[model samples]
Target: MQIPIINRSRHPLPAYQTEHAAGLDVHANLAEPVTLKPLQRALIPTGLFMAIPVGYEMQVRPRSGLAYKHGISIVNSPGTIDADYRGELKVLLVNLSETDFVVQDGERIAQLVVARHETIAWEPAEELSETARGAGGYGSTGMQ
Candidate 1:
C-alpha cells in the first residue's frame, strides 16, 4: 500500500528495521537537542506529513529499547494520527525515570504503525447481551 508523504526534514523517511516488521521507525526532527527532565513531557516533531488512506490510521508507539534503558515513553502510548490530518507529525514524549534524557536530531524516538480501522454507525440499544464474563473487569479474573 502506497501512501503520499512529504518529508521536510533532512533525515531519511521512516522505514521498517527488519524483515516482517510491522512498524516503521520514526525519527526526531530538531534544529537543536532537547532535554527532558525527570517526569517532563515534550512534543517532538518529526517533520513528516502524509495523506493516509481513508479507513486507516497511523499509530505512534514507543521504542522498547528507549523505554527499557532510558525510561522514556510516549505520553499518549499508541498515539493515533487520523487519516484526515495533514499537519506535521509530532510525538508526545515523557521521561519516566529519575534522570534527564536528551533528544537529538534524527533520533529514532518512536515507531509508526499503519493500521486499518472501521467506522461504525451507532445503533441505539437498551441493554447489552450477557456473557459468562459480563461486567467482570480489572482483575476480575484471578491471577494464577
Candidate 2:
C-alpha cells in the first residue's frame, strides 16, 4: 500500500527497518535535544505530514528497546492519526525512569503502524446475547 507523505524536516522519510516489519520507524524533528525528567511528558514532532487513506489509521507506538532499557514509553501507547488529519505527526512520550533522558534530533522515538479500521453501526436492543465469559476481562481468566 502506497501512502503519500510530505517531508518538511531535514531527516529522511520514515521506513520499515526489516522486510516483515509491521511498523515504520518515525524520528524526531527537533533542532536540539529535548530532555525529559522523571515522570515528564512531551509532544515530540516528526516534521512529516501524511495523507492517510480512508478506512485506515496510522498508529503511533512505542519502541521496545526504549521501554525496556530506559523506561521510556509513549503515554497514549498506540496514538491514532486519523485519515482526515493534515498536520505534522507528533508523539506523546513519557519518561517512566528515575533519571532524565535526552532525545536527539532525528532520533527514532516511535514507530508508526498503518492499520485498517471499520466504523460500526449500533443496533440497540433491550438486552444483549449471553455468553459463558461475558464481560470478563483483565485477568478474569485463570493464569497458567
Candidate 3:
C-alpha cells in the first residue's frame, strides 16, 4: 500500500530494508546528537508527516538490534499513531542500560508499521460469557 508522506529532513523516506519486512525503519532527525543517560528518555523527531489512511494506524516500535546490543528501547513500546494526526513523527526512546546512549542524526531509531484497526462501539451488557481461563493471567499458566 502506498502512503502520502512529507519528509522535511535530509534523510530519505522510511522504507522496508528486506523484501518481507513488516515495518519501515524511521530515522532520527536532529541538528546535533542527543545523549540519554541510564534510565533517561527523550522524544526523537523523525521530521515526517503523513496522511495515514482511515481505519489504519502507524505503530512505532523498537529495533531488536538496539534493544539487544545497547539496551535501547521505546518508552511507549508500539506507540500508536492515529489516522487523524497530522504532525511530525517522533519516537520516545529510553536508555535501559547502565551507560549513556547517543542518538545521532539520520540513525535508525525506531520502526513504523502501518496496521489496519477497527473502531469499537461499546455495548452495554448485564453480564459476559465465561471462558476456560477466565480471569487467569500473570503466570496463572504454567511455564514449560
Best by TM-score: 1
Per-model TM-score versus the true fold: 0.96, 0.95, 0.96
User: Which residue window of length 10 is worst by lDDT in model 3?
Assistant: 135-144
Tens-place lDDT digits, model 3, residues 76-116: 99999999999999999999999999999999999889999
Clashes of 2: 0
TM-score, cand. 1:
0.96
Q: Report the number of clashing residue pairs per model.
A: 0, 0, 0
TM-score ranking of the models: 1, 3, 2
Q: What tens-digit string does per-residue lDDT give for candidate 1 at 1-144?
A: 999999999999999999999989999999999999999999999999999999999999999999999999999999999989999999999999999999999999999999999999999999999987778889987654
Assess the local accuracy of residue 42 in candidate 3 as a C-alpha lDDT between 0 and 100.
97
Candidate order (lDDT): 1, 3, 2
- Candidate lDDT scores, in order, read 0.96, 0.93, 0.94
lDDT of 2 by residue, 35-69 (tens): 99999999998899999999999999999888999
Q: What's the lDDT of the predicted structure labeled candidate 2?
A: 0.93
- Kindly give the stretch of ten consecutive residues in candidate 1 with the minimal lDDT sum: 135-144
Global lDDT for candidate 3? 0.94
At residue 3, give the lDDT of candidate 3: 80
What is the Cα-based lDDT of residue 33 in candidate 1? 98
